[model samples]
Target: MYVSVKGGEAAIDNAHRLLADRRRGDRSVPALTLDQIAEQLVLGVDRVMSEGSLYDRRLAALAIKQARGDLIEAIFLVRAYRTTLPRFGFAEPVDTGAMLVERRISACYKDLPGGQLLGPTFDYTHRLLDEALDGDPEVEPGETREGATEPVSRIADILGGEGLIEEEISGNDEPDDINQTPLEFPLSRAMRLQSLARGDEGFLLALGYSTQRGYARSHPFAGEIRIGEVEVEVFMPELGFAVPVGRVQLTECQMVNQFKGSAKVPPQFTRGYGLVFGQSERKAMAMALCDRALRAGELGEDIVAPAQDQEFVISHCDNVQATGFVEHLKLPHHVDFQAELGLVRTMRTQFEQAESAMENKEAAE
Candidate 1:
């Protein structure tokens, strides 16, 4: 068994070496640089950064490359590296309202105040692959048009003016950090959002989809989905001022769900918000739906599905924990297997002896 373990360790080392060779491919072809990955595979890098809860684009790109483009693995790498870094003081909350709007669209209005600026979206593009991209691609400047430089108005704000939506409270309560503290249910709104932000994208996507398929049945509309860069500020204790730390690309989704009035309250449009660290629209949207569904109790809606269950959703959402447990099946469990084997064998022997005794008694009779 020790020999087998030693052999397995050696095999693992060799496998890593082989993987590194494969990741680099041939010497003749130039290796892909981190900058190239950061620029070209921006979406993937964004996902890794968002899930990893870190915003370093270069690190995200490096993780992606090291993981051989496996996004979940890349996320794991970034997250593991993040734990070793020293924690400086927390950054001040960003004001998304003041974001430099790149792509802002509202499903609620035909034309918003600034009009719809469809910036760099694949919404209308054909799904066919351009063969020109297979070879060395040329960097060319595309046509740029001047549009709304004015700050885009939010659809939720318009609804709020008419008292059609629930009132938003600007409370000064500090948000709980689940990363620092262990999780206990039922989670607070802040903790819920934090958990979802770092939760597995695919898991959230599936749960969000289940709601759409009549599981929880929150009639949702994408009120607004905005993608842009927001300036991050950190509060300096000594300076007594919040200074601009950096800028990060963000995808924010606000979903509006139709809700009927309860016995004591008037009907209004409810909201679910999703904000991620990078250009992740689908993830943002999925997160929004799941967020709303999780708030079914707060909204006075009946909780009828797994998505609505707080414990079910939050507990199984983390990919790292899930993957670790699932992959542990690959490890040696000979002792465990032997225990089960012995129990089964003992039971079988007892059954056989009892059957033989019964047969002898019948013959004598």
Candidate 2:
């Protein structure tokens, strides 16, 4: 148990006040509005929402503003606020195949049914920083085409139809919610996906990178990455029908990994799925890699890498928990440190006495 340090209340209060003052820094400059943050720093807002497990863009912007641009702190604030809200009902599984495509690409196929739409991507851009961005300049409108009249076919579906890739089986069982129950080992694929969806982007990215470097390599290919708005629906008990609530922007990635079949099974492409809120392509791709890496046991692959360890990945992937444990070390540990210091001093004295006694005996002899 930890005891709070008394007599530091005034100091703590002052520190909080100072933090507020710093957050507001230089009143002469115009303060940033929530609209600017939500619209301009969209990626940051998306990250906070994804990790916080909350889907409020406005609230996420507010958290980013309050946390002074610290995405982790913004996520923590959003999560804390989320816990206070009551759940009305769960939404039905989103149909990504019908997503209003803003951007869609596949590394596996050069020309698919829905020709590649490179919408607002930095893939072809030179890495050099543009000096024009430092000044307010009129931005040129991008070329537009008529929106697709019908839903585009998913690449995974095409692959599955040809019997080239494993088909995803839909089940009647409701997936477990991590928020409602504690995570136990030997987690279901649904539970693992849930944990990874909200896992730290940096942590997942590193793990994903490690896999590419031959640590539990799963000869992966980005089968498809589509980003757009998907209609969300909730089943209404009163109406006996599902009603569309709203559309949420999502980035969905399907990674095709190589799998050598066993005696019973035939050689076919395996899949790693990632679906995240907003346009988080990097996060979605990273999630897919980690998701595939964690499937070692079920796939009958040797679990020799850290990424393959479900317990380690699931336990340490949460940035909130990791941050709390690491940051807590800054708190006072006076009693604990005092005991260690005393013990060390006693050992030093005993060692010195023993050394002196040996020298005297050697001289006398």
Candidate 3:
């Protein structure tokens, strides 16, 4: 095999130009606008924002257009672009508790303090193609659903009061972000959650389902899942307070799990948590289960399987990293493979000769 030359850069450039030409279609045809993509393919934009680790729908749409609808590539574009942008400040974590919530429901409660609001969902709608969208018809959504004044408290609050489950966020202290720095060996709650948020939806879904299939089956009820905009504020030491820096759309899920009798802990309910960048309740729910399953060791439960091991799950979670490395094997590896093949042949020949000599010696004896 010929030793490869490093013409990858030139090839990549040409490929990029080809992609641009294809995405644009005929030069005579109009190019699709970011707004159009954002409006028409909103679910794509949502997935990009959700998995891309970005909160901006417009930016996700732009990335999707630029990547020619390759979602993973679009996610990479968003992540790369986001790094260069200067941080203005952090926003106050919108008290989703005090949120002007859009959707809120509980499997754990009959009725919650903050009434359930099924704001905007296609949950019950049959997934039939509306031929109406075929024609160039312009339409607008109607007025917002009038919501309740009160915000909902978690159903786990009932269990928490009765001391059935361990508490969640420690109100007194804030956790550091894994993105702010590289993670060391052991991880904190913030770091673990951060890794899972950026992981692939399908991967998380599989891991979560494995638990139900007895891989680490811990029964969990969807305690509450909500999707909406939350106000974020960064603490300003100068002002000695956190100010509103921005708003981010988010999906959050908190699961109430049945924790049966273990060695140290009694039979009680526990919690699994997930918070992501956009309104993806499915991802959030799956993430919460996986998160709890990964916490098996710390929770003093059985760490019998890969899914139960925190290091195994979190280390393999990031799709961008995983996909890139896995695909790299597709690149030219002739030199490496040839060397390994030569070593194998040499070893086989030596083994055959040695066995022949041993057999002949025995015959001579």
- The numbered model that scores best in TM-score is 2
Per-residue lDDT for 1-365 in model 3, tens only?
A: 54475667898899889877888888786788999998888777888887888788899999999988998889889988888889876555567765556778777777767667776678878899999988688888756656544465666777788988877656656677777878775787778888889888888888898888888858888988887777787888998988777777778899988878577768888889998876788889999998888778777776887667777788887778888899999888889999999999999999999999999999999
lDDT, candidate 2, equals: 0.92
Q: What are the lDDT scores of the predictions, listed in order?
A: 0.89, 0.92, 0.81
Residues 1-365, candidate 1: write the lDDT tens digits. 53446658788999899999999989999999999999989999999999998999999999999999989889989999999999988888887887777888888888877777778889999999989899888868765447534467788999999999988767898888997878888888889998898889999999999999999968899999988888889989899999997888899999999988788768999999899988898889989999999998887778999999999999898887787899899888887888999999999999999999999999999
Better of 1 and 3 by lDDT: 1
Find the 10 residues in a row with the least total lDDT in model 3. Answer: 142-151
TM-score of every model versus the real structure:
0.93, 0.96, 0.86
lDDT of 1: 0.89
Cα lDDT tens digits for candidate 2, 1-365: 34667668898999999999999999997899999999989999999999999999999999999999999999999989999999999999999999989899999999999798898888999999899998679998887646653568899999999998987979999999999978999999999999999999999999999999989957899999999889999999999999999999999999999988889779999999898999899999999999999999998999999999999999999899899999999989988998999999999999999999999999999
- List pairs with backbone clashes in candidate 2: none
What is residue 233's positional error in candidate 1, in angstroms? 1.0
Better of 2 and 3 by lDDT: 2
C-alpha displacement of 33 in model 2, angstroms?
0.2
Off by over 4 Å in 1: 1-9, 145-149, 350-365
